[model samples]
Structures are given as C-alpha cells and as structure tokens.
Target: MNEVLVSEKLVVRVPCAVIEYNGKVLAGQRSAALSFPLKWEFPGGKAEKNESDEDALYREIKEELDVDIEIIQKLPVTSKDQGWREIILVPFICRLKTLQITLTEHEQILWLGPEELSSLDWTEADLNVIENYYEYLSVKK
Candidate 1:
C-alpha cells in the first residue's frame, strides 16, 4: 500500500503550475517514492506559512523542473480528502519562460494537449484542475 503522509494540520495548501507552452500544458509523473506513486500531476508543492501561491509555484517549478514560469492567471481551486489529510490545490495558468527543463523530483514529464490531458492517470485533485482549466480556456475563446 502507498503510504500517505498524514498531516496534523486541518488543511494543507498546495500550489500547482499549469505551465503552457506552444498550446500545451506541462504535466509531471510523481516519482515512485512519493505518496501518489507514478500518478501524473502539475509540478508544484505545499505552500509554506506566509507564502503566496504564486511564490510557492515559482519556487516549486524552479526546484522541481529547474525552469522559470510566468503566471498568467489563477485557475479554480480544487480540494480533496486523502482520508488522512485534506489538501487544497491552488492551480495557476503559467507560461514557460525557458525551454530547458531538468527534472529533479518527477519520474518523467510530458507536454500534453487539451485533448490529451485526460488520457493520463492523474491525481484526483489534478483531474479537477484539468477540468477547471479546460473550462477557463473555453471561456477565453
């Protein structure tokens, strides 16, 4: 069984990046050592106390992918319960500022199109993020 890191806190805040480049969104596969082993998700991590979601996203993308991103807009927030902890995912639509990516945390990464996003085995919160993002895109058009 996958070990879930139960948090003593009431709610955990996670900021995620929905990095877009050339009409594709970046998705990362969680490392096998992580809680959601091999599940696909946007690259980001838990927000520290007093840190904004945008700041956390910038820090996380740099730490995980070794690339800089420009936040374009904020997507709808998604929440999920792992039975051990509650997580609120703050997703942002971002533009990739650099081309070179060095993966430090994820097992692998992929640039997926709108139609392709739902084809992967994504985390539950990410599924919500994807849905919300697609709706956001549709409204923008």
Candidate 2:
C-alpha cells in the first residue's frame, strides 16, 4: 500500500475529487501504470503540504484534467483504509467552464449521466459519493 510520511508521523494523503456536472458527471479511467488500473474515478489528487483544500482542488484538476473548475460546493469527507493509514477524501461539486478536457494521467474519460454512473464499475472509494450523486440527480429529475 502507498504510504506518505509526514514529520515522523505517517499521514495518508487527503485527496479531493470534483464532480463536474453539465447534465452529466466526469469520470476518468486510471492509466495501466496506476494501481487501480482502468477503474473509473473523479478527477483530483493529493492535497499538497500547506495548501488549502480549494487550492489543492484547482491544482489537481489542472494537473490531471487540464481544465479550470469553479467549485460549486464541497461534499462530505470519506475515509478508507489503504492497508496503511486511512486516507481521507473530500469530494467537491464543480462546474467546468470549458467542456474540453485533456487527460494527462488517465487512459480514457467518460461523461456519464446519473444512471450511467450508477451502472459503472467505480473505484471503491468513489462508490458512496457516486450513489449519493445518483440519488441527488434522481431527486432533481
């Protein structure tokens, strides 16, 4: 399992994922080189040391998706064990001004509607939020 060492205390990373919706949510397929190869996940990454959540979100999206995002709202944080320390993930709902996304780290990307999202084989960490978002969409419709 991947572990991050912080100041003599091993601290797992806090990754923030963004749900970018324009009638659909964006999901990225992990590259073959990555641990969760081919599994779909929301676009984001680890929060840098001393960086704020919003800044980390922006930096991650720009690095991974190559697009700027406007954070709509932050969702609840979730924790999962990665065989090491527990990883805390914070998900955000965001709006993408440009639909054009250039994937730098992922193999493929999909823009999925709520129903489609529920049917997909998502990463374990993303499953709960995916279900929540699907429910939210069902209610909205």
Candidate 3:
C-alpha cells in the first residue's frame, strides 16, 4: 500500500493593468532576472496582504513602470494553477497619467493593438486574459 498526501493550493492575488494609450495596450516583457523571463505580460504585481486590488495595481504600476495610472474599469479575471502555486489574476482597464514609461522590472515594453497582441509570446495566464478581452471586444462591437 502507498500513502498519498493531498494539499490545498496556495492562491495568490495578482493585480494586472490593461493600460491603453493612443489606441494601443501596454505590454511588458519580463526581466531576465524574473520568473518566466522574456514572456510578455500586462504590467502589474501581486497584492500584499490586506491590500485592495486597485491599490495593488496603482502601487505596482508606479513601482514597476514608474508611471501613474488611473484605473477605468475592471476587466476579466483569469486563474491558473502552477505546480507550486495558484494565481488569481484581476485585470483593470486603465489610462496612463504620464506619457513616459520607465521600466524597473521589465526588459522592454510594447504598445500593440488588439490585432497585434499575439505577436509576442505571453505568459499563460495573460494569454487567457487577452482571449477574454478579444471576446469582450467582439461582443461590444
């Protein structure tokens, strides 16, 4: 007989920004020093304990991109399970307060239209979020 142990997943809340400027969405390429390096993702970070999603996003955008953002509305949520953890991703539609972006944790950034969103290899969760955004657009249009 073999003994098996089961454990519950550790869920982490991550606040994400789907920032639009001049008809393009902001995407960041992960830094080489980070997990999933070089994969493109919307700018955001994990929420601290007791932090609201919006506040986490605001602080993350400021800290990571060196730009302030005004969140417009909530977008779709995406969830995924990694071997070590489970992620709950909440994305918000946002507008940039400044035109300039200074990245601290990303190698580079791109401004792309919906049609061009697939040009880069995105993180698994982000790819799902993009699909939801596309569906939202198709329904809206």
Task: Identify the runs in model 2 with alpha carbons over 4 angstroms from their true place.
Answer: 1-10, 135-141
Q: Identify the leading candidate in terms of lDDT.
A: 1
Residue pairs in candidate 1 whose N, alpha carbon or C atoms collide under 3 angstroms: none
User: How much lDDT does candidate 2 score?
Assistant: 0.77
Model 3 residue runs over 4 Å out of place are: 1-8
lDDT of 1 by residue, 107-141 (tens): 99999898899999999999999999989989999
Tell me each candidate's TM-score: 0.92, 0.83, 0.92
What digit string (tens of lDDT, one per residue) describes model 2 on residues 23-140?
Answer: 7788888898987788888878888889888899889988988888888777777777766566677788889866678889999888887668867777888887776666655665
TM-score of 3: 0.92
How many clashes in each candidate? 0, 0, 0
Which residue pairs collide in model 3, if any? none
Report lDDT (CA) for all predictions.
Answer: 0.93, 0.77, 0.91
Query: Cα deviation of 9 in candidate 2 (Å)?
Result: 7.9
Which candidate order results from sorting by lDDT in descending order? 1, 3, 2
